[model samples]
Target: MMGWLWAVQVILFAAGTGLGMSDARRKSTEVRLPLWVRMLISLTLTAAAFALWRDDPASSSKEWIFWGMAWSFIGDLSMAGIIPWRHPMIGGMLTFAVAHVFYIAAFAAALHHEGLDLMNAGLAVVAVFYGLVLIAAWLLLIRNPDAPRLFNIGSLVYGLWIGAMASAAAAMAWSLGGALWLTAVGGLLFVVSDTIIGAAAIGGRLLRHQGYWVWLTYVAAQMCIVYAFTL
Candidate 1:
């Protein structure tokens, strides 16, 4: 089952996190570039996703997860400026948004696999709250004088994608319970990380080590989502 890959990922994740936290310490106003260490970690996760999907060749959800992770790897590269693009920042945002679409697909597939309905009173409440919060946050980001109009628009669009991903994961976890809760945790953590970035965009500068907050939560999010599924 390629279980040893988990150990490899763990080692890489720890190393990357340490480097990211160290690099983040001095970045006050600007977000740190997506460094090679982080990109290597992302690539490892993508490979892990593929291994998982290969293990469950019949599972549609696993297939979606693999694609999602692949797109995420591409997004990391785009953000790192390793990929050629006229505007790397916006390209990375849009690419990451596309990855969320695959995650939404994976959640939908998981729901179907579990024979659970996506619509329910409890999940509706959670979904509604997420929607309202996103709306308010989007308005705030767009109105910020410091952020460019294009960046604001991209953030709003990306925020909606992540919101949908979170809602889908929440519905799956709420219905299934148990280890699936990690998936929900991952989704929510992703929102937390992204929200920090958005807040920084609005306020110009965040507390010291802004990248540390963002990177730690984000890595946790990705780890939670992929491993929880195997569990």
Candidate 2:
């Protein structure tokens, strides 16, 4: 039953992503049906994914992951509305922020179980490099004149938290001898998705179709994290 549920979850996510890409293509036409369809499918996918392992072992870690997905689903709903102010992007960010916190906890538990060794020079170097990149990106957002001050500030804080989550995933991967490579990659992709979405929100016209890429990476990131548990 679990295996079948996992398969269905992946299929739903893939279909939703494809529909989201189509929505991006037709967004200029003001037809939002595809976007709504995709959002609904994505929501179902997350729920199904959570149901797959709700009764499995490692209950504590799974509980955190489940809550992470639950928060993500709320974030998705917050982002789905046409009224931006009614469901502000900041609200979505907060929801996802909490979700990331849960994800970090789960990753930490996994790292603990596997025994972490972060004294490696290479891992330190990579972490520092990634930290620098996040700082630069945060500064860019902070300096964008077109964005409202509140948005700029909120985005900076949210970006930092997400970056920390990604760093934790990377550290876990390093400690586990590349065993959690998918989770690490997923974390990076989540950062990329949020960065693009933020840039577009701040009046980056070139990134207008950013939703397609954002959802693609975001959904894949969640799926990767889910798969990592079975590894």
Candidate 3:
């Protein structure tokens, strides 16, 4: 039963990606995916993923990451709905921000289970990278006159939290030499996807060019995270 549920979840996610691609492929047409349909599919897949560890989640770190992935699923659906209505842009960004926070919590919990020290050389490198991201986000906000103040801030907060979470995971020391590396990679991919989305939103870049790149990155990010949880 667990195996079948997992298989179905993957198929659902794959179909979602195919839908996203189809949306991208239809150029010169104002084709947007049905908001409710996507939401329902995403939510159902998430629930199925969670069912794997429903019996004993505390004993399975993979389950914890799946919970975080569920948050991310919700965020992705909200963000996809934002521009179509234009009324929920801020709400969507906030949802995604909260989702990243959940991811941070999951990563931190995994690191704790590994008994990894917070202060380390890898962490220091990530700290420097994180500082650069902050400065870059600040610069983007300062220079962009059309950017919404609140959503821009929300993007920054999301980026910072995700960076910290990825850093923590990367530096963690596991007892058996491997610990949630897939999750860490997934988190990093999500950071890239979100960063691109934020830049496209504020900088007015990538609009004139191809639209598929943006959505592709978004799909890739989500798929990576999903696979991470299953791994």
Candidate 4:
């Protein structure tokens, strides 16, 4: 039953991604179909993933991941909604920031259960590498006058949390001697997806089919994170 549910989730996610990409490629400003369709599909996928892992006996990390997914669902909804906030992107950024916090907590919990050595030289190297990337991202976003001041600050904070999450996942994978590749890959892809998003948002420039790439990487990243626990 669990396997079938996961299959369904994958299928739904693929369908949602297709629809979203098609919508993004449309030349018309007015959307023919509602964006909520894809958002609902994404929410359902995360819910199914959570249900599949709800009874895991291995560690409480699964619960934290579930919360992260839940927060991601809310972030998606907030991003799609037509709210009249002063800074429109703030709602989505705040929700995703909470989601990243949950993801970081989940990865930390997994690291604890595996008894990985955080002080390992490789882990230190990974930390320093991502630390530099985070610093670069901070400078890029902060210097963008096109983005609202509050949004720039929010993006910087959220970027730090996500970078930390990725660093933690990489450290765990290294400490475990390459057994947790899913977490590492997922964390890296998540960072890539958000980096693209931040760049597009701040620079006000859309690359070719940017939305398609963004959603594709983002969905795959979330799925990989969910699948990491099954290993």
Best by TM-score: 1
Task: Tell me the lDDT of model 4 at 22.
Answer: 72
Error of 2 at 72 (Å): 0.7
User: Rank order by lDDT, top first?
Assistant: 1, 4, 2, 3
Query: lDDT for every model?
Result: 0.78, 0.71, 0.57, 0.71
TM-scores of all candidate predictions against the true structure = 0.87, 0.81, 0.72, 0.83
Cα RMSD, each candidate: 2.9, 3.4, 4.1, 3.2
Which pairs of residues have clashing backbones in candidate 4? none
Candidate 2 residue 149 C-alpha distance from true site, Å: 1.0
Worst 10 residues of 4 by lDDT: 28-37
Please, what are the lDDT tens digits per residue for candidate 4 over residues 1-231?
557656776676666566655775685432222466557656765775587566674567788888888888888777767544455567877888888788777777777887755556656787788778977966864348766787677778777777777777777677764546788788888888887787777756556666666776877788777777765
Specify the poorest-scoring 10-residue window by lDDT in model 1.
25-34
* Leading candidate by lDDT: 1
lDDT of 2 by residue, 115-195 (tens): 654445534665686678777876664347667787878888888788777877777777774547888888898888888
| Candidate 1 C-alpha lDDT tens digits along 25-136 | 6663344434765777788888889989998899998899889889888987886789977877687888888888888788778888878777755468777878888878
User: How displaced is residue 207 in candidate 3, in Å?
Assistant: 5.0
